[model samples]
Target: MNKLRLIEMIFFLFCSLLSASQKPNILFIIADDLKASVLGTYGDKVCKTPNIDKLAEQSLVFDRAYCQGVVCGPSRTSFMHSRYRGSMGTNLAEHFKNNGWYTARVGKIYHMRVPYDIINGTDGQDIASSWTERFNSSGREAHTPGDYECLNLNIFTDKLEHRESTKMPNRMFVSVSYEGDGSDQPDYKSASKTIALLNEHKDKPFFIATGLVRPHYPNVAPEQYFTPYPWEKIKLPTIPENDLSDIPNLGKSKIMNTNNSIGKYIDNQKKMWSAYYATVQFMDEQVGRILDELERLGLKENTAIVFLSDHGYHLGEHGFWQKENLHEEVTRVPLMVYLPGIKAGRTSSITELVDIYPSLTELLGIETPQEVQGKSFLPLFEQKNKTIRTEALSLLTNGKGYSIRTKDNTYMRYKDNSEELYDMNKDPKQFNNLAKNPEYSQLLKNLRSQLDLRLKQEAVTIPQKIKKVMIYT
Candidate 1:
C-alpha cells in the first residue's frame, strides 16, 4: 500500500476507536416510595443517608423533580415508556435492548406491591421483553417468622397463623425491626446481584437498572438500622389543627384519614417513623454497595448513573401517611444524574421522571424513539441556569385528579371540578388554599388552560397489544 493511504487508514481507525470508547454505560437506580425531604442530601435532619448523600456530591441534584403519577404502577409505567400516564409504548429498557445494549433489571422496577410479590419472587407489572435478564430478591422480610410485631394491624405474627390472609387497609402503617442483619433482605440481595452484573459486563456497553425496595410499606429493616433513630428521639411532622378545613371534599378524601387508628398512640407513630427511616438508611447502604462496586471495577467514569424514586412518599405530611395525593410531599421526588464530564451541582429547574428517557439517550448519543413525549434536559447539564420546562404535571387516581407545579405555585383541579391553588412562594408547606380568592381568578384560569393543553397533548389511545404488555400480575 502507498504511504499516504496507510496514514489515512490509521487516522480513520483511530477516530472509530475514540467514538466507540465514548459510548457510555448506563446505570439507572430507582427506589420505591422514597421522598425527597427525607434524605440528608435533600436537607432532611432525621434520616442519616450517608451513601446517597455521597452520591449527590458527585451528581447533579435536581431540586424540583416531580413524578408523572402519584402511585407506583402508573408512575413506573409513564417513566419507563417516556410518556404520560395514559400513553402506551415499550419501556426504556426494551428500547436499549433493541439498540444493541445489554439491559437487565434486578428487584422491583415496575409496580409489585412489596412483601406479596417479594414472597412469590414474581414480576408484578414488569415488561418481560424489556430485559435481557432479570432477578427478583426473595427474603425473610416477605414472610416474617412469628417474632415480628406489626403495629399497623395491631397483631404480632407470633399470635397469628397464615399471615398472608391477614386483611388490613391498603394504607395501613406497618413496621418491624428484624433480629438478623440485612444480609437476608431482598434489597441486600439485589445490590449483590447488581454488583455481580457490573463485574460480568464491565467490558461491554450495557444498561443496568437496580430497583431498591425499601422505605416502602410494611417498613421493615435490620435491627442495626433501627438503633440509629430511637422512637423517643423521632420527631413527629408538624401539622396544623384545621389542616383539612380549607380543602374541598374531593381533596379531603385523598388525604390519609386512617391515621386515627394509630394517632392516639404516639409511641406507635414513632415506631412507624423509626422503621421508615431505618429502611431508608438500609436502602442507602445497598446503593452504596452497588456504587462502590462500580468504582472498584473501574466502570465509574464511563457509566452514567441516574438515581431517583418512582414517586414521593408522605410520612405524616398534610395529615397523610402514604402516597396517592397531589400534594407537594407526594409529587416531589429526589433525582440526581451523574454523567462522566458534567459538573456536579444542584439545579432548581422543574423536571419530570419521564424526562429521564430522553436525557439519557441524548447524553449517550443514542437515537430516542419518536414516540417519546418527554423533552431532554441535557442542556441543563452544561448550563444549570437554563430552564427546559415551565411547569410539571402529576396525575393522581388515574386522572381523577391532577396537579400542576410551577416555580411559584401549585394548582390542583379534581375531576369533580373542585380546585386548589397554593402560593408556593408564601406557603411552601401548601397549607393555605387560594383557589376561592377573587383576586387570583385570572392566574387560576391561565394555569387551568395550560394544564388542559398538556393533557390533550399527552393523551393517547392504548393499543390492545400494548395494553396486554403493560398488564402486571
Candidate 2:
C-alpha cells in the first residue's frame, strides 16, 4: 500500500479503537412526577429547563413512554426490577440484591419516604431489599416549617404506610416535607453520596440508583431556586370545567382536585406554582451537579446513564393534582437515555417503561435476568424511529381498571367491564369518550379483546423449576 493510503487506514483504525475501548457511562437521572411537556424541548411555553433541554438535545427522548403503574412505590418496583406488574409478583425487593450487581442507592430509587425513602425507612415498614449498599439521609423536613411535614403515623390509627393507604385522593396529605442547607437536603445528600460512591468505585462496573424527590409533592425548595420565575409570571394549567363530565364518577373521585395550591386549595395559585417550579429547578441543579462530578472523575466514558420518572404528574391539568388517571398529562413522563456510542438527538414515541431493562441489556450485549418482562429497544437504536411495542398497558388498581395506549388510540377498561376509547391524535386531551357511541362500539370491542388476549399471555405463571434455578443463580 502507498504511504498516503496506509496513513488513512491507520487513522481509521485509531478512531475505531478509541470508540471500542470506551464503555458508555450511564447517568440515569430521574425526576419525581415530572411531565415531558414541562421542559422547553417538549414545547413548554413558560418553563425553563436548560439542563434537561441540553440533555434531551443530545439524547433520545421517548415521547410516548408510559409507566406500569402511576403510583410511586409500585411504579418504581417494576421499573428498577425490569418486570411488568403481573411478572413482579410481590418479591421485587429481594430480586435485585440476589442478582449479580453492585446495586448502591443514594436517593429514592425504590419506594420509601423522602429522607427515609432514600435510606430504608418505609415508616417502620421497609423498602424493596434490592440494594447491596443503602444510605439514609432522613430528617431534612424540619428545616423549614409549613413546607411539608413528615407526619408520624404512630399518632394515627394505623401504620398506614402500605399501598392501601394511598387508595384515596387525599392520601398525599399524610407525608411531610423538609428544608435546610438545600445542598444538605435528603435528595441532595443522596446525589452527593452518589458522587462519592462513583469516585470510590471507578474501577468496577456498578449499578448506582439515584432518585431525586423534588417536584413530587410538598414542593419545598430553598429561596434561591425561586428567584428566576416570579409568582406573577407562572401560568396555571388550563382545564375546562366540564373536563370531569366525560370521566366516570369513580375515575373523577380517584383523581385529586389539584387546581388549588398547597393544602385546602390555597387561593394563591402563583405562590404554589413558584414553589413547584423552584423545586423542579432545584432538582435539575442537583442533576447537573452529579453529571459534573461524573465527568470530573473521568467516569463518563465507562458508565451508562438512563434517566426516567416512575410516572408523570398533573400540575393542575384537568383539575387533577397527582397521578392515577388515564389522561396524557398524568401518564407521560420525561425519559431520556445518554449512551455514548448510540446516536444522539434522536426521539421515538415508543410505548412502555417495561422495555428499558431489556434495552439496557441489549446495549451492553449481556444476558438479562430470566424474570425481565420488557423487550430491548436496541433495535430502535440501530433503526431510528422504530416502534418497540404495538401497545402499552397501564393499570389502575382498587378499581379493577386497565388501559391500552397505542399509537393512535387509548382505551380504558373499568372493573364493571365498561370501556372508554379515545382517538388520541384528534382528541389529545381525551375530552371525548367514544365507548358508548354506536359507531365505535365495534372498535371498542376489538380493543377490549386485544387487551384480554395480552393480559392472559402476561398472566401465565412462570414455572417453579425456572424460579428455583434463578434463586440459586
List the candidate 1 regions with Cα displacement exceeding 4 Å. Answer: 1-22, 153-167, 253-260, 460-473
Q: lDDT per prediction?
A: 0.79, 0.62
TM-score of 2: 0.80
**Top-lDDT structure, candidate number:** 1
**Per-residue CA lDDT of candidate 1, range 356-411, in tens?**
99777665556788888888776666567567788998987545788889989999
Report the lDDT of model 1 for residue 432.
Answer: 91
Off by over 4 Å in 2: 1-25, 86-101, 114-129, 142-181, 253-255, 258-266, 459-473
Clash count, one per candidate: 0, 16
Residue pairs in collision within model 1 = none
| Model number with the top TM-score | 1
For each candidate in turn, the TM-score is 0.91, 0.80
- Give lDDT tens digits, candidate 2, residues 1-473: 44335334433432342345443334456677777777777777666677777777767777788887667765675666565553344233244334444667666665655433333434222354656686655533422432342222212222223311222333343322233458656668767888898888776556777877777665566656777777677777766767766777545534345432242443344555666677777777778788788879877656667788878776566666567766677667778777654566665556677777766655544456777777766555445566667788777644467788888889888887766789988988777888888998788888988888767765234444322101000
